[model samples]
Target: MPKFAVVVCPHCKNAFIMEPGHKTVSCRSCNKRLEASRLKVFFASDDFKEAQAARGSVVAGISGDTAAFEEALPGIGRDVMERIGEDVQEQRYMEDKRKVNEKMDEEARKTKKKGQQAILRDTFEELAENGDIDIEEYWKKISFSGIDRLKFDKWVEKLVETGVAYSPRFGYLRKS
Candidate 1:
């Protein structure tokens, strides 16, 4: 299933919906880069309504506080009166999506990439032809260094998880 998140774009000072876990988001309004980690959480309409209704009570609670809070109120007021209003929260959700778009202007840019495990699995299929293959011999044939042996093991583990490859025995592999 697809997952989504609502976020406020600090670059454009606008609200936009986005998928979480992106390294960067291009602001639709300003076309500026927005680091997903720096994005602000957007409140839903219902939450906005509730906050609006409770704004008076929140001020009341703050005003009715002790002298220490009274001293802090000035700083809060400065932040509030800074000629802008925005609420930022840090929340992360996990999901995967791929976006392709065409527009009135130029063509869209996409940088899709294959994962390492998929590449290794493809190599297995091409070289071994689905037969039982010795792992060390295969790596030697490919001319990969000794350091890559551990990394290759990790890649094979990922391939096994995807149901595309399997370890039939110690130091041996076959397509699933």
Candidate 2:
């Protein structure tokens, strides 16, 4: 047989019924997250009658009457509370780390794009001033600045994309 117990959401002070082992539920009234494991169950036994008198008041155990409720609710152990705290802290830490990583990745992409734009600008200026695409001379000009020949080649591709310059022959650039 399905058993039902009167329980209240610890988060929102909303009273609701729950199965004995239903460990999570959402509050209908406030829509706040409710830990069903934290829900105080009402026992039909007379031993709990005095404790259940002010049902709503005792529901959350946060309304300054927690000592009596804790004495009655011995099933919720100290370790469980500790584990819950640790879990919440760990979850927050992981979320913070993920946000930091995403920000770093975005910043890295922006930096790389800026570097590429700088390379494009320098290559364009060199080509414009020289008017003749001496590919070797251009490499020698930028080599000491740590720009490799392959990097210059990629920038030359960008120049071709700009429609202001093109390769009329292999190893040569001509103004268009």
lDDT for each of the candidates? Answer: 0.50, 0.59
Candidate 1 off by > 4 Å: 1-119, 145-147
- Writing each residue's lDDT as its tens digit, candidate 2 over 19-101 gives 56566777777887677777555422233333343233334343444455445444544653343334434544665698899
Per-residue lDDT of candidate 1, residues 1-176 (tens digit):
12444554544444555666679988777888888777654322233333332232223232343343234334234443221122221111111111122331223122112344445555677867848888877676544432356777776677679976678889887877
Error of 2 at 103 (Å): 3.2
Question: How close is every model to the real structure, measured as TM-score?
Answer: 0.30, 0.41
C-alpha lDDT of candidate 2 relative to the true structure: 0.59
In candidate 1 the C-alpha lDDT for residue 170 amounts to 91
Which prediction has the highest TM-score against the true structure? 2
lDDT accuracy of residue 50 in candidate 2: 34
